[model samples]
Target: MGGPDSLTKDTAHDVASHRIASVEGENGGGKEDAKDNALQALSTFLRDDMEACNREIVARMQSPVPLIPQLGAHLVAAGGKRLRPLLTLAAARLCGYEPSPERQRHVGLAACVEFIHTATLLHDDVVDESTLRRGLASANAVFGNKASVLVGDFLFARSFQLMTADGSLKVMAILSAASATIAEGEVLQMATQNDLSTPIERYLEVIHGKTAALFAAACRVGAVVAGRPEAEEAALEAYGTNLGMAFQLVDDALDYAADQQVLGKTVGDDMREGKITLPVLAAYQAGNEEDRAFWLRVIETGEQHDEDLPHALDLIARTGAIQTTLERAQSYARAAMQALDIFPESEIRQLLMDAASYTVSRVN
Candidate 1:
């Protein structure tokens, strides 16, 4: 939960400390403020489209089973930034797609994207045994794991219904493939959990399948609906993939470095769960024998004590793992920005680029 300054003192990694400071300072008021401004700008730009998407989301989530709607509304009302759905809507608009009364494919598809994301959150909470989400009690905690899992299944079914109604096999193919890849990623994560020896390449595979696939699918669907060229579709997909990577890397760093109040969930939850992230890998790779033994006891053997988290944080900070993680995230953010260069200059394009910058800048 400590900031860079709190974590950096008395450490020999001066260069990494300075790099962290410089990156945070470059965002002006703060990374959190910068991210807030970026999200607000995107939301305002896509207000009408988002409203339609919300309506579609509500309508599709309804069912005769009262518990379904109740559970779905609880999660929806928790009010995440809706970044996935927003990506779909924004990417569509950026490709010159407009919604009409008779044809609002983007809106429905945006809602569909949200359904998939929300379903994953429900399932993930159950799997991670998570109690909090978006600074509120998670659905699994409130509704029981059984209900949470069932509701997640319901949402997945609903997403497919929306996709089928869109009547585009290409759209269906992209989303369905993403859904499968997400499942595979979760399985892969489970396989690698509590194992300190998991390689960086394997970790990248996990994140790409779990997070980036949907991001890429969401953006590519936009180009598909607009009947854009394959080149443009590939470009947007690349942008989304890189942005998702940056976003997840920042999230991992924040688990070790962010204020708990700002982070919404418990700090070090990943460490507590013995999940091997980039920070852990970086720190372990740089640590000596004693440090390696410590990681083995806590992470591999699942034997943690009251002071273990602080020690882990110290190790991560002293090794400059958080800074290293953030720097890698910055590279992905830059790649995401470059992917958009093929598109001509426009307000939407700029907003998309800002969104990519915000992916790395966000502290929460």
Candidate 2:
């Protein structure tokens, strides 16, 4: 495996641009279509397994209470990329595990990963007072915060049931610990909200727990199910962790820069909500005294006006915060690609590499 230094910025950009162009050529579409081309490719490659996993997800989401499934189905229909579960399935396959009647644990576990993610989205939307999710009305908006919270709890319970059904103490321990860490991450984010003085280390810790923990657990369980060696498990965990960090960093950048139509959510939601993400942090760190005062007014004091978002964007742009954040994401994506060096060359492995590239390319 190469070190992070092995993949320079130019190299990462060239590789990702080439991969994006390849997908665009194949699909006869533009760069817009290329954003999710890796996910589409992985979905096509794992169509059968993903179908089975979807079935398991639908089945487990059911409840006697009508609203449980209704709210769950609404979220499912909104069509998130399901990246974590895909990681689980892809990792299992990369480890040479095939689903069978007696050995179908991966499928259920994949569904379990989705359940956990969905539950988090529900709770997060409620906490953030978000009205939109994936360009659709948020569950909390449509179903009410109480209903969304209760249904999220229901999904968490269902996820646990699937974990118990898997009958692997190791799997249960991995996922359960991730769940706890996710909660702590959310709380930590809350603690840091509206506080511009939050350190970079604390911000990294929050994202590691909030986003990367489940990603690591999801990939690790795939190796566990395949009974692969501990080294392989650790490799996949590293890949997922770095991939997740890259993903979140790009997401934060997009919050300020992306087109709402393309981003599938309102731009500047983080800024409006006083969340101090990497872009904000970097901009604040680099800004002059007046710039610091601006961030203090809009973010720290939460006195944002309708025109404040544009000024914030200008500040971030002038300080090159968005570019810096994306570069940081590229480094993580490079590390993620290097992590997969332990695996032998194969179609699945190449697609996994492309997926890491896609994580950084998303901001392009």
Candidate 3:
């Protein structure tokens, strides 16, 4: 919209690097050194790319629909970590799209990822009937659910329009499949809501569909757009999936473990809404009869009070649900790092790998 100075490539890279940590080799001397090298290189490139992405988002989102501009601004200005677009950039780099003219094109794709993500938030707020988002009034809350839903649909259409403009049939395929998966995931979640009989396996399945699917798509699209080899494409896909899974696990855990201020959302929101997540599944699996009944009552009958929070948390904590969820997240993060092996040893690869580590453990 404006000049790159508004976003400032220098600023965007700094934000992207925080999402991950490097894997250490057993030797301690070689792996960390290599990872540091990669991190430095990747950090330099990401700042410029993220800045460009931010600028494009600002300019490209101009719309005829009044609600699109208003609601889109609220979500974009919320200042998220921009993880989806960052992954696209990382995958492109891994796929051999370097610092050249083609790189700028990659920035557009990155913006697409962020736009699609933001659009999802608009829709999710309506579906969840959420009053808040990104530490502010949710679009559905301030703009009304009808407007929010309509605007969300508009954004979705706009995202597809952008993809078609890019003229990549493959890109369209990747995005289309991801969109379908996301819708199916939402439906799966809807089916499970308020249903205490839901199993742990089903919960993870829903998480993959709703959350990780797009993450995988972001990375896959980047690699494909950049004309990377199949191995590299697979690598980016795996990386996105693992990173996505880790994020959801941590997100679920945060609902129980984090401060409302730090989380930028209300405490126990999922529990209050009866959306059973991984931690809840783990807790239920590990709980006793009495503990199980307590959770069942609070979740199904909406009988919860603040006083029940501690007991519920204790039950979750005592059963090692928090640790269990964290461990699951870590497993995915590890898988993400392993997928990066196809790419030759590079500073950027290390940063991407490290990013996987950081995503699961980031407090904020």
Candidate 4:
């Protein structure tokens, strides 16, 4: 289990085939090449906002109080790729938000998205009793749970205030609904913790409600706020939903497949926490009776330990659970690309497509 991740003989064949397809995809010309090139150029647009917004984030979080300095500084400094905020900017630009023509409304909106996301993370760590985030002690670990929760609330209120400045009822409605939905998802996840009997449908529902909804809503807010056409707005929302699902799927995969160093969390951590993810679903469907018994005794009994990792990985492999789960992730990514047909050929649009592909297929 501590060795390099290697597929069993049967799955190795699938990997071989997948490798060929990947090589072809990577080297493909015309559309694919252009997509890659466009995505490369996106750094120019996202880099400034990513850095400036991050700096401003620290500045904005500063309060005259003592606790605020320690806690807020830790949170604002935590390394995140800031994809949600980046998505907002991309949508704004696509909708034709010109810095000169109409002012950079995108900056405020993107910041709002990030604020809400960070607030949620702060609270989620407390709920999960998580010790680590982004390969470091979680805010709750450093600041203590009470401070984390209260500070999270402060951020939520601040995000609400920022959203109001956007001056769009539509944007406000979308984000407000998203925030409420996320809260519901937290409750749903809590209700189902360590529930090995949780059906695949229920698992999908929880992920959709908890994770994908916000991505969809956030992208929708961005596109709609920038005054994109209805069809393009819908397309972007679909893009976000698909991308979010793919991202979560990969996250779930890495929880089982990746090293603690690469993943910023321990492998099998999800299983230890009794979180029933896609691989678990695949294992349940494909496992033998004894394998099922093993899962039930460990996961259902809420007694899974670090030692249970091998059995879990073996069972998943025996059942080809990992393979099936990865396939599902790819399916979602492909569906996302289909949604992009609404947009005309543009560097940004194609780059979005490439980025979506990369999100689902990441190794860690």
TM values, all candidates: 0.90, 0.90, 0.86, 0.85
lDDT of candidate 1?
A: 0.85
Residue 317 in candidate 2 has what lDDT?
A: 96
Please identify model 4 stretches exceeding 4 Å from their true place: 1-41
lDDT of 4: 0.72
Please list all clashing residue pairs in model 4, or write none if there are none. none
- Computed on alpha carbons, the lDDT of every model, listed in order, comes to 0.85, 0.86, 0.76, 0.72
Q: Model 2, which residues run further than 4 Å from truth? A: 1-36
Instruction: Give the range of the ten consecutive residues with the poorest summed lDDT in model 2.
Output: 1-10
Give the per-residue lDDT digits (tens) of candidate 2, residues 122-221.
9999999998898888878777899889989999999999999999999999999999999999999999999999998899888998999999999999
lDDT of model 1 at position 192: 99
The 10-residue segment with the lowest total lDDT in model 4:
1-10
